[model samples]
Target chain A: MSEIIVNAVSKTWGGVGGVDRISFKAEAGTLLVLLGPSGCGKSTTLRLIAGLEEVDSGTITIGGRDVTHLSPAERRISMVFQSYALFPHLNVAENIIFGLKVRGVGRAERDEKLRKVADIVGLSHLLERKPSQLSGGQRQRVALGRAIIAEAAVCLMDEPLSNLDAKLRHEMRTEIRALQQRLGMTMVYVTHDQSEAMTMADRVILMRDGHIEQNGAPHELYNEPASDFAARFIGTPPMNIISWQDGAMLGVRPEHIFVAERNGVPATVRAVEYLGADSIILCDVKGETVSVRQTGYCSLPAGTQVGLEWQNRHIHLFDRDSGKRLADRAPA
Target chain B: MVAAVMTAAEPKTARHRNWATNVNAWLLLLPAIVLLGMFTHYPILATLYHSFFSLGRSGPAEFVGLENYRYMLDDDVFWQVLRNNFIFALATVPTSIGLALLMAVWVDKKIVGRSFLRLAFFTPTVLPMIAVANIWLFFYTPDYGLLDQFLKSLGFAGHNWLGDPSTVMTCLAVMVVWKEAGFFMIFYLAALQSIPPELKEAASVEGASRWYFFRRVTFPLLMPTTLFISINALINSFKLVDQLVIMTKGGPNNASSLLLYYIYEVAFNFWDTTYAATLTVTLITILAAVALTKFVYLDRRIHYQ
Candidate 1:
């Protein structure tokens, strides 16, 4: 019952640069991601839930307890910051058990917990090393160890993997997901990287301009975006959004479209991007740029004339003026 | 034969270039070396050399060879001033440092009129020591002084602050602390600013109270700055002589005098140049020992980022 319910939380500095009345719920034992670009107030929302920022209005609850006015510690939550914030002077072991010591836990219990957490984070051998001596990854582990050793029911992360390199980011992403599940902690992870949200989150809350643009499971957001913004924000190549007839926009995923010989929309092959597993053929339909994903190598040259087609079920229509998804399906 | 000769010439040219680089480096170092040797090294050596000699007030000076040292050991005024100097340091250093840290932490917060408060705290540091001493001297002046007048309003009797031996050292120490704490606060403020805000936020999230966070994290991280400020403060305690000259002048009975002021008195007023040189040598030895202990011991124990 460590579920967190953020009800209409709003925080702003002089009516600017903070979350609008954002509301969401993170169920117990589930990883919910708040995904957005910079300045979208994703971090602000997490900080609000963590009680680091006082909301201008509305209440936040943890496990049915209204913690809106409680301090960060009083909320009974742990957090991993983007910078990791390992104390430079304290060694790994001391850092892991710092919170326990702060709570006046016994020395023997602290040591036992330290050993277990050190092993879990794979920092047992490096316990005596100061943070300055550790590599970037190891320092991140120290921060993680510090956060998890508290055994708090709820944990919040603020773009924790943004500091790591690509390979390490991937590694930590999987490791963090596994650890979160193992501990059964209700976690709200914030990240600007949609791939991270898609890969690690049980539910993703996509934000825009301090408000939620869309909220759903990853596949739902990908397959059925609520608006044009959500369509272009997910997936690697993202969904192709082009102007359609009569004040509407047609949406199609890059993978859903295929090259057709005839009886389809007329387009020209603009370029080809060959990824290892698949090739993306860039095509110009009328005036809009559309990319069609093709398996294996795409031998189409830049100036080749081509026709693009997709199944009726793959096409999405949105009203041009509002950018909201149209309920009706397009003519097949 | 030509190839062999080409290889043979290379080492010689390389050696010549190396010699030129050495000379260039020395040329670059010339100005600083010249100034330090002329003003600092030469005076120290000259002081040490003169400490063993007689004043020769009546005739040519002669070698005294530790006579001034023996006389210093027996002089009551020397002992009194030395004791006063130590008492002055012990009283001023920690109090000023603590006050500076407190002021720095206060101003570091995002409070209303913060810049104004910082400027107010720093105003004392910008004043000349002579001006500061004169200002404090007026405050400590007997019945007509601001302190006594205020105390009188509180129904307390007027007391001589500087004229009395018992109160003079304490008065001077209070003035020095007031003048010096703001300058030290600048250093602590800078150190506090350099610490990442994330550390405090992290500690807060961990259920650590503000006091606990400061005690364990902020204070430990500030060790390097503390060590630096402490050493500077200690040396400053010994080096300060300007305020004493203006305020106490070694007092009615040499009660508030420091070693440097005593040396000044021996050298210029009494015309005891050799004994003054002896005192200067002792002062230099003490300062050197303090610096050496910091470098050899404290620096190793403290964490520097």
Candidate 2:
């Protein structure tokens, strides 16, 4: 098994910002995304797994081998940095085959592998160009080519697509997912963008302040968030959380709540955001801001009174103080 | 009619404005141009003009084309000094540069006492060359010098370091390298720090050994700084002669005399002003050629960020 098991790993610098006792297992051939905001220790966790940073406590195993104390070279892994980190002086082909040359691969084998990897990454025509000569997307492709050329079983990516524009990011996202599936490489991708995690990951591990808030498949995190933090972190226009009675919070996805004619929680429409395929109607309910996602256009103007309603099955209850999800659903 | 007249007059006003802009630009450039021409360009031209003429000792100077040049070709001392300069350059340039790069790489690490190490390496560069020469002079003194004392303690015979002809050039070369390497280290240190840490991380993840990564990535990336430092070091090898005045004085039969010191001797001591101009012309030609080769050839070969 080429799975990566990070067992209770903790790394902190000078009693400051770092991951704390975070543990997760990335199965072989699956893309596990470490998703969080900045300074949430997502990148640090990836670095620890790559052996770039040592775990202060606990054991890290890659393919069932204890590799916590091993050098990065002995760990048998590859990583793509957010900056791409292509050697500026080397041409694309040289950069891609640098690792092969370091490992003493012969010229013939190096050239053959270079050609294959170049073709795979769609950089055959641009082999001789330096990184300064390539576009951002092309540089990213070179970085990708370099990472995959080693054919390491576990590949770690730290916000690799964060440098690209929106459209290119989406394109590279799908391409990377497809490539990971094709190569059967266990990938631990880190990203701050929740949409990237929701779309690309086989499993999503949401982190908050160095602790794992939730860990499950993407749909599972979206549908059944274990805490209010996970519920708010998963979806776009994320799950609507509002103050409820008796020191509890009521959580419902924006898609679950709808405008009703009568006999629902009364709210005032504060504003409307009209996206092309859908719209988000922002409403004020008892001095708390909650958004409701609707299909197509939401033509409700500001200051209009509306009643929001959802089914009892869609209601989620959490303790206000702890933010932990309560097992029992609210009354209908 | 008025419109046509205005159109015809527009060109004249535009020309006037252009003339004013040109004058403004020239005014802004006037100080630098005047200073360089007076101090640098004029001296070089005067040297070249004087090189072809005879020194007027008892009468007016007369045109003596190629006389000094022929005499310089026949001068054994001049030939020896020229050869000595080449050897000195060859000895000091590469050694100093290599040591500088080594020191820079060492101090750039997160080792213990890194700041202290950096300061220690840089201390030599801050000392004036005359003071440095004096310190080295004390060390190279014949019998009771530090070097001799150490050698005597080792049961070896104390020998002349700077006084002997055989060891004079080597001694001078060693002193020059020691004095020069620390300055060049600053450049290499800056270049090393500018390299993004992510590149090292990426290389490490690819199973690259530290030495392998340095050979392939770090070294190639530092090529521009290396070229710059080498050219400066080469020029300095020819130019710097203050230390020779203090320690060797081109002594014991001009064995350690560089071309510049020989030129100083010919110009000031021997009073051969025209011949001195000829030597100066040759020195300028060599320096100009070195600078030109860097600009015309090496700059293209190096990779600048």
Candidate 3:
């Protein structure tokens, strides 16, 4: 519904650091997740887009309207805060329709929209309850309901799933993604959890130290990460890294560094992690360590001599100093 | 059963911490208990004992029954003073709390030199009330005070602030607000600061205008704090009487006298012991009511995460 454009948008907190020289654009109705570790300025960038924060320089445009100088209420957008920030004093129904009420929406239309949003967020029965009376998941749905009732072209979510427990987080993410797609509203979600971003976002803008390390589709960011930071950041057990001579860092997914019998390199098993499905083998070779995931929890013992080799196609090469992906110029 | 018995016995070993922890626990509680006994328990016993009889200098007091209470109901000055006390509480409590909230919100905004503004709001509270009365006395002077000087500049003569019956109560109200607003502002400021910034930001994102944000969000959120502060202000409004001595002397018609000042007059000025004790009971009753209301409404609403 809205195309968000950041033209040389930079937010500097004068001295220390914030999102600096950040410039990107999201096409209409697409979900763009700004993924990074905590304090990496992703949240600040989202706030800037929502007009909750003032940028130090440059312009932001949504649906071809410049909004750099506008306040958040004037932006015709809604934000789901990390804490949800539902008005505790207001009951669930009132919380949902608070935005419409403020805009002088007629009571009938407000009630209609409230019913629609509450139904959409599955909060129909809980409308009479205060936010304090609801469970964590229900509060989040109320927060989402508030956003949806606004019917703004763009919705900014700042780590909204972070407060929920893991199982509920997974469920909410699916529900949120489904809702976003069904409504076709532009969403910019900020999260430190790569899995959340990977599962929810159409495109992930991976950030580090106030800079965009890579921006691409989740699979693109995963399967062909543009930098070592992206390579190490995307995978769960994390990308196992080995520093070769002349400072090239060999990066590969844990599963890719599996136990192999075909022309394998010399190594000794350091420790074996017995996960139910697969066991991860931590190995040592020439005073360096690398983790390898083997299929099925094998009874691999410590001090076992092992050979380590990976699929040539799956190995990721990262530059020595720059840490940029050596995709095209990787060593043979 | 054996595991349960072992688990139950495990805590017995922990409870036997060799006198050191027992002594530490007692040490921590000792000061509070002793102070509570000395200040809280003894006073109640004494007040109850003293309430039944009249205390006379150098004599065992006689039980006066309901004579003191009966006398209080009929005393003209006591009725007038009681009326004046209510007027003082009414004028000061609501006005001070309202103005303090206004000042707190304004100062809490991103104003330039906000600390200086806060200091200005709180300056009178830090000053001794006697000194503040001295300051207001000079300002209230009919001929040469600041009010008269300003009025004279405008081609008008300011009436007697402390002397005029019509304006004396208002003057007292202004003085009390000046002396109390900043103190109340501290409570309001704490409550304001404790409100999560995201609450207002979320309201903004919800397209709530400033008034809607305040009425629906901020004020409702501040209700418990407001009630608490109002109760405190009410009790203090009835008790503090320094300005009465300096500026009014409970005149120019006993207009500005408070319950405490009236009690002071009865006990010390008129040399009436039993009746003063009766008024003291009245004062304690009102104070207790205010305290009870505060506890009932406020202490129950501790903000939860």
Give the number of the best model, judged by DockQ: 1
TM-scores of chain A across the candidates, in order, are 0.98, 0.98, 0.96
Please write out the lDDT profile of model 1 over residues A268-323, one tens digit for every residue: 99999999789999999888899999999989889888888889888899989989
Q: What is the interface RMSD of candidate 2, in Å?
A: 0.8
lDDT of 2 by residue, B1-305 (tens): 99888869798887899999999999999999999999999999999999999999989999999999999999999899999999999999999999999999999999999999999999999999999999999999988999999999999999899889999999999999999999999999999999999999988887888898899899999999999999999999999999999998998799999999999999999999899999999999999999999999999998989
TM-score of 1: 0.97
Q: What are the per-residue Cα lDDT tens digits for candidate 1 across B8-50?
A: 8798887899999999999999999999999999999999999
- Alpha-carbon error at A329 in model 1, in Å? 3.4
Ranking by lDDT: 2, 1, 3
TM-score of each: 0.97, 0.97, 0.90
Native contacts retained, all candidates in order: 0.86, 0.90, 0.83
Lowest lDDT sum, 10 consecutive residues, model 2 chain A, at A323-332
Worst 10 residues of 1 chain A by lDDT: A323-332
Candidate 1 - CAPRI tier? high
What TM-score does the first chain of candidate 3 have? Answer: 0.96
Provide candidate 2's TM-score on chain A. Answer: 0.98
Per-residue lDDT, model 2, residue A70, is: 95
